[model samples]
Target: MRKRATAKEVADAAGVSKWTVIRAFTPGASITEESKRRVLEAAAVLNYTPNLLARSLATNLTHQVAVFVDDFANPQKLPFLETLTERLQAEGLVAVLININNHFDHVHALLNADQRQVDAVILFGTAFRNETLSDRQLGRGMPPMFVLARDSQIDGVPAVVCDAELALRDIVDHLYERGYRRPGFMTGAPALSTALRRRQHFIDFWKGKGVDEIAILSADRYSAEAGAGSVRHYLNDIDPAARVDVLMCENDILALGAMDEIRGNFGLRIPDDIAVVGFDNYELGGASCYGLTTYEQPRIEMVQAVIGMIKGRLEPETVTLPGKLVVRTST
Candidate 1:
């Protein structure tokens, strides 16, 4: 086996004291530029890289974050994962992903995070209960957490989310101005809190505007197949006489599915007979064929907010960013 090169050996080769060599490797340590240069050159020649684990023990900071996400199949989540990991890498923080699909899985992931000594945790969904992450449950030295795209408040857990109510208001305003009175919502599974929040906000916003009645249909999941089925049910079973003038979907994928069904199955013209709108302005929304009118979440801004909390630059509190309404041909 090859002998490992130590800081002492680097110091001897660089003609500097061991203290100077340690200072040269430490961030923000007071060391002369000449000494640092010599120390780095000797380290390179000796093939000696500082052991991050040993340094973490000394500084009490691993600079590693554990990210937990459930909806890996969701297209929108793919971009979110990419952007988050890239940003963490740019900031010199290591990111470890824990793909959990349920509450029990989240608890296990939390335990794994603690075992790995991660500096922070970022959760991507709202499925995990707040109490499961409390200090009493997690013990005294639990990592600070940031929940992304979750609207509900989890005690002591900060969240970075988009304004669901604001997005719904924007859609309603656009549809109303375009002479759409009988508006309906096509959303995800009944068990999903995100779907419930979006549906309730739309209903409340319209009700507050003195609109007495609004229709809502639930899909089995947030997928194209479920969206198409919901639209079929809404048109055939719920509003068989084609009473709805506009359909607002909870996600872009849902909207696309509804659009396909409307044109292919129902033979209804889009934005002519009935307009369609969606949220999460996924990249496919910009395609000429779809051109879906929707609200775009400020994902970059939300990520920055979460990073700020991790770095102690921002308070650990829920931050809701306003979504931008992208008007397209679909509406």
Candidate 2:
């Protein structure tokens, strides 16, 4: 096997010090253009690359951000993850995806991230709760933490999330204008505390308009099957004449599933029989099959805010960005 070339060899070939070679490879590091060009040329010739482990040791920063996720079943998470990883890479940072599951919890994920010396930790899923953030043991020696796509009530922990109040207001106004008098909401499991905020916002916005009586339905989990089941049960239990005219779901996945259940099983025509609206404009929501009217979260802007916070370009405070309402045939 051939031995890898070292930075010292590249430095010698470039007629510069080893520190100059390091600066040439480091992002945003001060280095003369000529020196950087020589270092790159020498590095290409010798097949030399700076050791990230060594660099982390010297700088005390790994340039790695730990992102904790658990809700892989939801399709909306895929787009958010793609946007987040791409943005992190663009900022010269790496993302360490940690799965929070039945066996491993948020506290355990926090410990692992801290042990790995990650520059920051991002809670990107519903698995993390405010109680977990308040854990004293997990707080010690922990890296800077932020919440993405969800609101954080814990002080000192900033969050980048969609403006739920504005989204819900827009949704309610649209529904009211469309003559949707009786409104209903479909949510995920009880464990999803973050989703409760959206549900409450939906109810509050409706009540503000004097529509006091709103129906609520909850799924067993954050999946299409759970959503379908919840809709099935609600339809079976409610009288046809008193049923809700419009259903607002916590997410696109639930709305998609509810639509399928409503049409496929009950033979109900969308908008003619019942209108549906959802949050998070997933790709399939735009498809002709579903044509789901949903709210589009400002995913790119939210991810950029997170990167800005990491780079100190923005303050580490709760940053709420407004999203747009997407109208489709479903509504």
Candidate 3:
């Protein structure tokens, strides 16, 4: 087996101190261009790289951010994760993804992240509850935490979320303009149905406009199958006259399923018999087959805001950014 070159060897080759080599590798560390060039040339020749573990030990910062995610079934999560990870990498940080499931919850993930000595933690799952943030077992030495893509009401914890109020207002105005008097909302699992305030905001926005008796349907999960099943059940339970003119879904995946169920199973014509709308603006929503009219969350902006909070450029408070409504044939 071949021996790996060390930093000391690189320093000797570069004719500089080991500390100079360290500064050359460290981002934002004070080092002259000539010194950095010498260190890099030596490192390339010797195939030497700084040990991240040793660097973290010396700096007390891993440059790693733990991102907790659940709801892997939802396609929207994929784009958000891609955007977040790319952004984190661009900022000279690494993202440690942690999956939160029934077997392992947010509390468990928190402890695990803390044990890893991550620089920060970002909660990206909708399944997490506010009470979990207040859990006594989390302890005081836990790393700084932020909530992404969802509203967090826990005090002192910053959340980078879409402005639901503005989104609801835009949706309601568009629906009313399109003559959608009776509105219905399709929500995800019971755990998330209450956790996300979009459902309540949808109802409130409609009620404020004097549109009473908004119908609500709950899906078993965030999958398209659950969405299709929820629509199937709702359509079968209610008479045609009592049906809503437009159906709004919590997310794009649910909306896709609902459309499939409405068209494939029931043979209903979209925008004529009923209209469907969704949030998150998943890429599939723009397809010609579905042409789903959904709300486009400012995903990039929201991610930048989270990074800003992490970098101390922005305050760790609830930051809400506005999203635009996408008009398509479905609506």
CA lDDT, every model vs. true structure: 0.82, 0.89, 0.90
Residue 47: error of model 2 in Å?
0.2
Inter-residue clash pairs, candidate 1? none
Best of the two (1, 2) by TM-score: 2
Query: Which run of 10 residues does model 3 get worst, by summed lDDT?
Result: 188-197
Best by lDDT: 3
Best candidate (score: TM-score): 3
* Poorest stretch of ten by lDDT in candidate 2: 188-197
Model 1 spans with C-alpha error above 4 angstroms: 1-4, 102-104, 134-137, 189-196
Look at candidate 3 and tell me the lDDT of residue 21.
Answer: 94
Ranking of all predicted structures according to TM-score, beginning with the best and ending with the worst: 3, 2, 1
* lDDT (C-alpha) at residue 230 in model 1: 86
Clashes of 1: 0
Error at 113, model 1, angstroms: 0.6
TM-score for each of the candidates? 0.91, 0.94, 0.95
> In model 2, which runs have C-alpha deviations exceeding 4 angstroms?
27-37, 191-196
The TM-score measured for candidate 2 stands at 0.94
Question: 1-331 in candidate 2: lDDT tens per residue?
Answer: 9899999999999999999999999889999999999999999999998899788998899999999888888888899999999999988899999988999988888888999999999888775677877788775678988989988766788889999999999999999998899999998866443433888899998998999999999886778888899999999999999999999989989988999999999999898888999889999889999999999999999999998999889988889999999999998
Q: Which of candidates 1 and 3 is the stronger one according to TM-score?
A: 3
